[model samples]
Target chain A: MTEHPGADVVIEAQNLDLTFETNDGPVHALKDVSLTIDKGEFVSFIGPSGCGKTTFLRCIAALEQPTGGSLSVNGMTPDEARRNRAYGYVFQAAGLYPWRTIARNIKLPLEIMGYSRSEQEERVNNVLQLVDLEGFGGKYPWQLSGGMQQRASIARALAFDADILLMDEPFGALDEIVRDHLNEQLLALWARTEKTIGFVTHSIPEAVYLSTKIVVMSPRPGRITDVIDSPLPKERPLDIRDTPEFIEVAHRVREGLRAGHSE
Target chain B: MKQVLAVLTVVAVIIAFWYAASVPMNIRGVLVEAERAGEVVDPPKAADRRQIDEFELILDNPFAIDDTWEQERPRLPAPHQVAEELWDTTVEKKITSKRSLVYHAWVTLSATLLGFAFGTGLGILLAVGIVHSKVMDMSVMPWAIVSQTIPIIALAPMIIVVLYSVGVQGIIPKAVISAYLSFFPVVVGMVKGLRSPDMMQLDLLRTYGASKAQGFWKLRLPASMPYLFASLKIGIAASLVGAIVGELPTGAVAGLGARLLAGSYYGQTVQIWSALFGAAILAACLVGLLGLIERAVLKRMGMA
Candidate 1:
């Protein structure tokens, strides 16, 4: 694992730390977080709330700056990588502009990046189809259901086609059935696109099912507790969760979370 | 259909009240004229009649009650008298004549519209500045609020005088006053609108490395449409009032304000009522026009 070439490393964080200075005092949002995400790897940061999982993802996206240590994305500082449009970050909420149609909302980043009118239209159509929302582009955000809105938001992030995708609890608001369906769809998407993905969530099954690796973290000066490389096969079916290997990984993640809480 | 009926019912009630009140308001004039014609009176002297209750006088001289609404000049003009004067000035008289309410309304409307355009443009510009810069946010907002504290009536004559001394006259002076009255609402509403985008929305733009201009045109400006329209409705009404007030102190002869002044000077209560109605109608039409535009724009944007 250590012999992997430098060029394959999409994201590398070295002992990253972030402390928020609020009126109450200091909050240790993240501490001593270290990880490397390789090209085309689906990495999940799974932990309970305030475990610095979202904060870590935000640091990689340069939305939040680390107070200590160094982090790099695509071999550049997060800020530089951000300026180069290195990744697309999806928020917890769909956050689609009410005034923009689904197609137009997806076209927002493209418009900012100065894509030509024809190219914008083409890319919007492509992402719409990619997310299985092809016929619904002309509808407004409010016209769509919650699950569909989240899917449309995914399509929006995918519109710019950056090599990396960072999603912070994208399906946290969804129901279990919708979440399972979306999880399956997301695995299929990751397989097809071959993009490095950093996903933040607290659901053990979701993390175990979707990720090539699971980084378990703990709160109280938040830090990583475990890094588990899945032994499951690359082409995973939804029923794979019932398999022994998937269940073993899920058990390990639970154990790691329990250990973090007990300490 | 229900809304129209509701509005008509309210208007009918108001007219009924106006007609009932006009009896007492105009009875003294009717009694004096009746005495001049040698009609029988219970109270022999005008001074004695003044001491009697107006309704009691109406009961004693039932025949004179019919003359109250038809008086040439009364303390309070009856609803029908004002309506008749409005119809005569607007429809019966030629539009180009001095007696035509339409010509006067047009003069006031032009200034109101011109002032509204200037006010809206300046307001939006100031709002954009306030949103983008900390200095403007802290400095300009307080001043905008302070500007509103000074009554437009107190400020209007000074503005007219200041502009006139500098060789600016006619519609420009009135438009300036209108603009003054209208801009504050736009500035406040637009500032709120431009800042309406949540942190997550702004962060999404930041992820794309969107420039300030892009963030504004793509997010802030579009989000502000509903607020802008609301402010514009208020601003337009204020603009009309400013234009009319601007005419008052200047003694301008062409606008609704001038008509009001002339009517008061000559004790033409019907003319004054008609001018008041004309100003109100103009304000309603302007606000209604803005409402139509707001609905159309928001519908196209799918925010309606």
Candidate 2:
């Protein structure tokens, strides 16, 4: 393991292991999983179910405790980083509090983080605009379409302006067309914000298209099988999926998944 | 329009059933009165009249059936008799008068509302404690359950006696009993309500590094609204029962329960039925009011 010269590492995990003790027996959710995510990088963890992809993301957000390993965010413990408001996490579901309107839901983190009334408003408006949900702020989550609800949730995560954004299949529940549109919007938001994003996804195309680096993982003692640095340029159009480089990366990820399952 | 018609249809059926039942129930008393009035009596002797069935007497004397529904101090008062008593006591009598059903109802309602307030407050507090602390969950929840197992009828007298010894008479003792009955449902329902937030929602709050208090106010509290309203409806009904029961042991001079006791002592079946109806109507109004508020609050919160 070597660091890229002058690259600012945002997250580092070494020999990470988490075994959940159940009635059946000990389930090894993650075993000796090691990865590093750097600043301004779009890193996607792609794998089948129970592959520790979401588990690893949860570990970064300090929502899970690693049993036997060192994991750090910006050189601080994940818990400390969490306390310092270092990252914003988006769940698979939109999870916008149905009782709150879009604007209020976005302001929830700001309110929790002790942002001033004026600043909360401003940030909520800015993120709503960024997610292309500017006018729908006052509408309740149920009033919005599924895609729009998810965008509102994204706006919520972005409102606090954390340096790291951890998303666990944020668009997994949406239709392909809606997913594609959200993907494009997400990329535009990432480029503008320059936030290091850690995305978990099951779709190889989604991983290959949006991520700067794709970490392919395997299940049953979950660990990384392959790490592919995408050769596609930062500015990706939906048509870029047709490119040879995109196909090549997708092929490698598929191979890694197959190889893991064969073990 | 359809709902109103459905309710009216049900009420009409019940009233018709009541009117029919009144004939058989009051026939004996009506026959005895008919004999006293020197009407054509079967067997022409009081001792022989007792041997024959009231239905047989009614068959022999068809004219006596009309008087059955208007009997004074009959075994089962007719629906109209109870309704007339209710109207006379509530509308004809002054509210301040001891004979007024409104005065008695106000007495019972005050204790019910007071007890409900105390019960709801204590229940919510206990639920918060039970939800937040493992010690309370383990230690207090079982005791709360045990408290409910004790028959309130048996407990009501003891509660009154204990309160009287301490110079705490009047509404407080009754309110305490009401609170006792109402708090259990709230504790159980609220524990469930407070714990209703899913792992994802809780984890979302954790990711923001939210404190327990913040999580409670922003997440758990609002999420529990529907459950809270559900528990409150049950709690209020229980409170009303508690208030009535509490009145019984205390020998309360003014309350629906007291009216029932007095009516039974005097064999005034109409008065007892009217008091029972009053309590039922009051409970319905209270529960209905809670349902309305639940709708309004949940609608405002966008959960309705």
Candidate 3:
């Protein structure tokens, strides 16, 4: 996650700050945070619950306004980028509209973008196959397992083929086995799509395994405590978790998280 | 099937109670009328003029049960009399006849449907306003609540009078009252339904850069279907009641309410009971239609 001199910058944050004014007082959620994500880079933000990892991701997606400083997505304001459909966001929960079938849920963005009916169908089928949920298009989200539902949510985000993916705790709710399986599948998906990813999670192993860059953040006046450039290679297998290099990256992420908590 | 059986059992028990209660309620009237008709006009002979309590006369009468069921001006009509009256008016009489229950029910039904449509549209519009704007939520919602506090019974006459003065007569005034009674439930239910999507869901839509109109059509409106149908059920029943109440103050001799008024004036308890049953049946049919539509729509939407 060292800055690649020639790599195109997809997302940039410069002295970004977001403070929420509560009834008690002003709660500084993000203070003077700055980061740059290059094209095709998978960046993971790891920290405690109150840390502004999710907040920062939301700010990038234009779901939340930064109280101060400048943040840009695709060299434009977040709001403008959002309007341009620069990114696909996968939330912590599947957040599928229960009223719609899996195929219809995937087609939602395409429908909003006013794609042709045939194009929407083709994209839905493609994304469903991409997520390994081809036949599940007709089924409802409740009929699927939690892992499958999350995958469907991912498919929904991938439906319109955006350049960037912002995933907030997409696999945090899954058990370890499903998490591992999904992690491998996610890496494969990322390699195939080559989209810039901004992932938020609390698990050190997940961050270490999936990310080229890991951002460790602190709570209270939420700030970035450490930004580790992972030295592990890009082609990660499920068994790589047992290797020494993977363990070393995970240890660094853990130490960084601990340092954030201690501050 | 089990729910139907339970409902049928309750209906049977109620009919049994109604039959039993009608005997007591109609007996005093029957006894007085019979005594007047059979007034011992001829002076009783010494053997027949025994001292007895006033209750002893009714107790001694063997045909009191038959008389109670057949009284022309009964205080409370027997169940069979009410049933016969309903069947005769609804089936034997022509549907277009003024005396027919079907004709009167249609009159009331038209008003109920018109008012229900108006209320539902108004409620949805207001709910959208309340959800999207702080000003409407703070200002209009309180007034909507306060509007319900004024009893429909007290307000119906004034609404009729005011409408009559402005040359708005008959169905319009009744429909207005029906709308007044029905709108509150729709507003409350729809406001809740429009806001039903959780923070994650809203944020997900925002991340997609969905406009307010798009968000409403895709998320809010579909999400509110169940709540809207539930409110419509309540609202339809209220609308029917409003229509009947609307008929009462206007002195119209057409709808079921007019039947009730005429029955009361002429002391025809059976007619009054028939009109009441007619109104009840109309409300049930309206609500049942809504339920069917709800099931079809919700199932089609994959929510059921």
User: What would the DockQ be for model 2?
Assistant: 0.88
- Please identify model 3 stretches exceeding 4 Å from their true place: A1-4, B1-5, B39-63
Give the Å shift of residue A148 in candidate 3.
Answer: 2.0
Candidate 2 per-residue lDDT over residues B18-132, each given as its tens digit: 8878887887788788878988777678788788877787787778778988888988888888889989999999999999999999999999999999999999999999999
Q: In model 3, how large is the Cα lDDT of residue B181?
A: 88
Give candidate 2 misplaced runs (Cα > 4 Å): none
Alpha carbon deviation, residue B250, candidate 2 (Å): 2.3
Collision count for each candidate, in order: 0, 0, 0
- For each candidate in turn, the interface RMSD (Å) is 0.7, 0.7, 1.0
Q: What is the interface RMSD, in angstroms, for predicted model 2?
A: 0.7
Please state the CAPRI-style docking class of candidate 1.
Answer: high
- Overall local distance difference test of candidate 3: 0.89
lDDT of each: 0.93, 0.92, 0.89
lDDT of 3 by residue, A173-223 (tens): 999999999999999999999999999998888998999999999898889
What is candidate 1's lDDT per residue for A1-263, written digit by digit as tens? 25466649889988899999999999999999889889999999998899999999999999999999999899899999988888999999999999999999999999999899999999999988888998999999999999999999999899889999999999999999999999999998999999999999979999999999999999998999999999889899899999999999999999999999999
- Ranking of candidates on lDDT, top first: 1, 2, 3
Candidate of highest TM-score: 2
Q: Model 1: residues >4 Å from true position, as ranges?
A: A1-7, B1-3
Q: Which candidate do you rate higher for DockQ, 2 or 3?
A: 2
